[model samples]
Each structure stands twice: as C-alpha cells, then as structure tokens.
Target: MLDSDYTQRFLFDDTDVRGEWVGLERSYAEVLAKHSYPEPVAQLLGELLAAAALLVGTLKFDGLMVLQARSTGAVPLLMVECSSDREVRGIARYDESLLAPGATLSELMPDGVLAMTIDPTNGQRYQGIVALDGVTLADSLSNYFASSEQLPTRFWLAADGRRACGMLLQQLPADRIRDSEEREASWQHLRTLADTLSAEELLGLDTQTVLHRLYHEEQVRLFEPRSIVFRCSCSRERSANAVISLGQQDAEQLLAEQGGAITIDCQFCNHSYRFDAADIAQLFAGAGTEGPSGTRH
Candidate 1:
C-alpha cells in the first residue's frame, strides 16, 4: 500500500513519558501532485501534515481531526486533516509572490490563528482556536497543547515538502514516585537526545533503528505500526449538497450556462463529480428520498 506511511509511538518502562516519531515522503508526493505550490507553501503544507500526524499520535479519539488556519495576508487558508486510521489530506491556499522562499508561519500568516477540529464519524464535532504567537509550526502547536490540554509536552517537526517528519514526547502523571526531580531530569536528558535527531535520520531510518540510535540506553517498547494513507472524504452526494446550497435556481442557471450539466470538483482531492440533465431532473423532480445526485449506486 503506497498509503502505508511512517510514524512510531513508544513507551518507556522506566519513565512516565510517552514518545512518538513520524515521517513522510511519497505520502507527501500524493498531496503535492494535486497542485504546484511555491516552495514556502509546500514546506508549510509539510509542516501541517506533520502536525496533524503528531496530533493523531497524541489524542485519544476514533475520528478525523483537522488543523486549519485562516489568514488575512499572503495565505488565506491552510488545511491538514487526518483520520483515526491515519488517512491524511492537506492543501494550502496562498499567493505565491506574497511570500519568500524561507518564510516562517508567522511571516506567511501574519494575523492568523491556529485551529483544531475533531469530527467523529458518529458524534458531535469539536473545535478549538488559539492565537498564533509562536515563530514555527512546532512552537504554535506546543502552545496549543499547553493551553488546550494543560499538559507538558514537546514536539519536534520537520519537512522539506518532499518529506515531513515529527516526534512527540509527553509527560504522563505517575501514581508513586521516589524521585520527582529524577523523573524530570530523565525526561530532560531524553529530550536532549531526541533533539539531536536530524531530518535526514528521521525520514530515512526505521522505527527501531532510530529509537536504538537515540535511546539505546533506555528500555523502550515499540508498538505495532499503524498505516497511513491519503484519503478524501468527499463524494458526489456531498458535492451535490454543495451545488444544492447554491440553490436550485443558481444550480440550474450554471447548468443551463454550461450545457445542461454541472461538474462539482472536490478541492481537497481533485476528484470531480458530474451532474447531467437526468441527474438534475431526478434530484429536484423526484421525491426527496432520492439522494442528492450522482451518488455511487
């Protein structure tokens, strides 16, 4: 499966902190293939992709989580969504000329705020918004976790558009402790070692290989790997709802102006859904039970 992506989460038997590692290469290629983003846009997308994966690793939820930003400056919007199953999709809406090659998130989205939303398959949607004061994606996300979860966590995320990577280390409250300072000291020491991990090592090494190289002295237990892939939740029926929101008159007008047919394309995945004369007729003419239009039957 080309979707079989990179990420590793582990627990240390000696410490009360959990850790995770994630990387991306061809997985990013899948998303980049849809658009010709500028260098900064591509790099930002990679960071978002890595951030989404890090959130997936940290949160306890069985649904999709989306990280997005709406800016009033160079980049209008950037979205990165990942499901519980590790299916990821991302896009960046930006003006190429407004940003430079090595622009940071604050530079690109000057007055932007970061937001995180959770959409369960069968539950209420949850969302959170935070100010963007941090200089980098990892910094902003760390601020989000500190404010939202009130947890002491660390995140190291990196990417080059072609590949993205991340590592998360978090403190878990312990019941009994002989030396609280020792635990903190151990975590600090471990993070120092993890800090040395380079983007190349993260993107190129295997889970155990990287862990051994970083924390070979500690007792680390690696979990079974979970796969990741590019999956878009958009469908023709959903697209039809979009067209319907345009109202029957406007839809018909667009249909009439475009030869009695309308094509709805999903911006997330570039998948197009076509609605013809019969589809339009059946949609508005028949009983409401007849789904939106062009639903895969």
Candidate 2:
C-alpha cells in the first residue's frame, strides 16, 4: 500500500541529479477541516502545502521554511509552513466572489509575488522572491530556482480535496570528473523522463512505483522515507506572550471591555484560549520570570 504523509528521496547513481517525492493524506485533510475553504482556495492551498514539503526536504536545517504568495487579485495571500521535523501547517485568505470556476494560478493570483523564507533556530533567516509569471505554482517555483538559486529544478504538483502529492527533480552542481556537456546531457535525459509523469499518476501511485515507472532504465537509488504530520505550534503560553506584549494596563482594559476575559484564537488549528482578569494579572506578574509565564496546552 502507498504510505500517506511521507517523503522519500531518490538519486541517479550515475548522474548529478536528485529528486524528492511527497504524498499527503491525513495531514491535508486535517488542514482542510480547520476551515470551510472554497474549492479553488482549498486546491491552491493544497498545492502550496505539497510544495513546501518538497522544498524543505531538500535542505538540512533545524528551522521552518515558509512559502508565501501576495497579490491584489482574487487570492490576496496564501501561506504554507513546513518545519525540519516534518510538521506542517497552512492557511489562505481570498475573495470568494473573485474565484471563478476552473481558475488557473494566474487568474487567481495575477501579478503575485512569491516569497520563500528560511528561518533557522540557530542562524539568520534568508528569503528569496520571484514574480508569479507562470500559469502554475510549479512553474513559478521552477523560475525561482533558475533565477535565485541558479540550479535547474522542476516540480510536478497535484491535489484533490482528499490528498496532495508532489515530485521534485533537481540538477546538482557538476564535480571535477563530470564535464559540463555531459552534465547537461544527463540533466536533459532525466528531465525528459520526468516530463512524462501525469498528475493522475503522481496523486495515485506510491513513490517507489512512480519512480520505477519513470526511471526504470536509469540507475536510481531510493532512500528511507520520513513521515509528515499536522502539528500547530500554538499554545496558551504563546498567546499569553502576545497579550503581555500589549502591556499590563492595555490587557486589563481589554479584559474589562470583553466582560472580564479576553479570548485568543489560533487561526491555524482553530484552538480557543480564554484568559480572565485573574489569569491576565497572574500572567503579567510572572512576566518577570525567564521562561514561559502562562499555562501550556
């Protein structure tokens, strides 16, 4: 059976090329369940989720990778985040009336700016931006790699309401033994094979089966797969910190206005946290401490 919510890496043993395959089931459904998104919005968000997982799997870092698109079109913003540990969360904001049936990426987000941010726990953050000039998210991302990273990369992404899946192929830098012409020829050959993959195959087949069907004649080596999961990093402590940032006096004033309590809701997971006046007072009192002040959930 195909393993849902996992990513597997593969490489051409004889060429400077590598790839990653990601399939999402439970995680995708969990994200959708949190909101009543429209069909186009949900489908676009799913593709973004799959893209984030594919990109993050290519790196070795202890941080979060964020994929964001901003535009003044039908879809104002779409964001997806994936952590190094394989935890994923995403959300989208769009104008329903503008979303037409069977809309392409350009129709939904005309003149959009796509930004990818890498925020590491122990290092400085880095970001790259590219214009949404392509009709599909995969094409725009491929353009990003060409302009920003200067690496040849291609992506095939597909999603239904039930599951989201994606495949990525990247050409690595040539080493001393590999000549430029030979590397180019190898990349061309691999890309030719990858171009034959269909959305139906990507969404329905297992990683091993899909790779074999595409690169059956190539020297392909598959690596162990890693599980992906839906996990929100929100907590009462983080919410309390947001409240504390408003200052003690403002927090009290807000509490009074809200009938003796302030409610904070997490947009990602739809988790509600209520802080009463006493809770707010105690939270401020413990603000001087070096660690998290409020109770965790």
Candidate 3:
C-alpha cells in the first residue's frame, strides 16, 4: 500500500542481466490533474514518466534525468523529468483532433527524435538522442542503448489514462557467464520469459509476484525498492528572477501593459507567481538590496 509508487530492482543471480520495475499511481494522477489532456496524450505522458523513472533507477547521479521527444506528427512534443530523489513530472503537447483511436506510436510521432539528458548537479551534463521509429517508446529506448552505449538493454512500458508501469532489463558486463554463446543464450532465455509478461500483469502484480511469474526457475536477487513521487521544481524566487531577466525597460513596459503587475506561470505545475510594482522594484534593485514579496497561487 505504502509502496504504490515505487521502483524495485533485481539481479538474475549469477548472470550478467539485471532488471527494474517501476509503477506509478498517485504520481500519475497528480500529473494528470495539472492539465486537461486527451486520452492519447495522457497515456503517452504516463509511459514517458514511467520510462524516465525506469532509466533513472540504474543511473548514479546527483541531478535530473530528462526524457524529451519532439515529433512531426500530431504530438509535437512530450517530456518527462525525473530527479535523483525519484520525483517525476511530465507534460505532453498534442492536437486532439489529429489523434485517432489505435494510432501507432509512429503515427503519433512520425519522424520524432527522443533525447535522454542527464544533468548532474556537480558535473557535466550528458545527452543521448535516438530516433523514435519503433512501434513503441520501449523500442526506441532499446535502439538508443544499442546505438549509443552498445549496452544490451530492453524496455517494456505501458500506460493507461489512470496509471503507468514499466520494466527494464539490461545485460551487464560478463561476470558469471563469460562465454559469448552462453551469454547470448542467457539473454535470450531471460528475454523469452520477459516476453510473456503482459501489460495487465505488470500493472496489477506486486514486485515479488511479477518476478516470480517471470523468473520462476531462475536465481534472482531483489534489491530494496525506492519511492517515486510527483514533484515540480518551480519556485516563486525563480519566477521573480525571470522577471528580472526581462531587463528594466521591457519589464516596466510589460508590467504597465499588464496593469502594473506581471504574472509568471510555470508550465509544468500551472502555479502562478504574481509580481507587483514594489516587487518589481525589489527585483531590479542593485546588489543584495532585498528579496521580492512575490506571491504564488
């Protein structure tokens, strides 16, 4: 119950393969609540959110991991950001009238490109880009790993309007099974079992049950599960700084155009930050005069 939104990792004991499972319920609902998204858009966002979480689980960093896709089809853009703390938020842009029932991923995102960005707080940022040419997002991610890092990775992602779930299985460096043919056999065997996993089972079953169902005869080592929550990193102070970036003349003109105050809204959270005249003055104040009295709604 308490672990409704979490990620669990496992190692196929004595093998070079590891896997992760991510399920989102409340966090998905919270992202859905921020704006009114069509069914297809909502479903895509959910999958992206789950995918971001799944990828971030294997990474060791002290910053943000972002998955962004830009397409030439109905869905022009979709993005999901997950922090090292396991917080995730996502948004999708789409033309509802252009969407059709049972549209394939390629149809929804023709000629699209997916970018994975890892922005470390203390180090340089790294980004990997892949073409979204597969039947699903999972396929595109697998392609990314294949082309970019040459790591053998596979992903299974599913998202309804209500919840999102995903699984990740990757082949690590040869440790237990060194023979190339043996490794290939092991990977195929594991993937064969994983292929039997349905989206419904992934969404409904617990980690232990899911693992048992897939790897009934394998030696698996389960790790501690981590919690995932929905969080937007928007702040009134950042909003105020945005106003300051507009410069004195433009900021004043815009304030005047907006009836003596300017309102900045965060697209991710839809939170409004209102800055009045004195607040503006405080923002453009030279040196460390004082902070603005901006209010958030």
Among these predicted structures, which one has the highest lDDT? 3
Worst 10 residues of 3 by lDDT: 286-295
Tell me the TM-score of model 2.
0.94
Task: Please report how far candidate 2 places residue 175 from its true position, in Å.
Answer: 2.8
Model 3 stretches with alpha carbons more than 4 Å out:
286-296
* Higher-scoring candidate on lDDT, 2 or 3: 3
Count clashes in each candidate, considering only residues at least 3 apart in sequence or on different chains: 0, 0, 0
- For residues 42-67, could you state the per-residue lDDT of candidate 3 as single tens digits? 98899999999998899888999999
Taking every candidate in turn, the Cα RMSD to the unseen true structure, in Å, is: 3.2, 2.6, 1.6
Clashing residue pairs in candidate 2 are none
- C-alpha local distance difference test of each model: 0.80, 0.88, 0.89
Between 1 and 3, whose TM-score is larger?
A: 3
Where's the lowest-lDDT run of ten residues in candidate 2?
A: 288-297
Name model 1 segments beyond 4 Å from true.
1-4, 176-180, 245-247, 257-259, 286-297
Q: Which residue pairs in model 3 clash with each other?
A: none
- Candidate 1: tens digits of C-alpha lDDT, residues 81-184: 99998889999899867987667788889988999999988889999898876888788888887898756788777777778878888888864334889877
- Predicted candidate 2 versus true structure: per-residue lDDT over 89-206, tens digit per residue: 9998989889899988999998899999999999999999999888898899999998895678999898888889999999887762278888888888888888898989988899
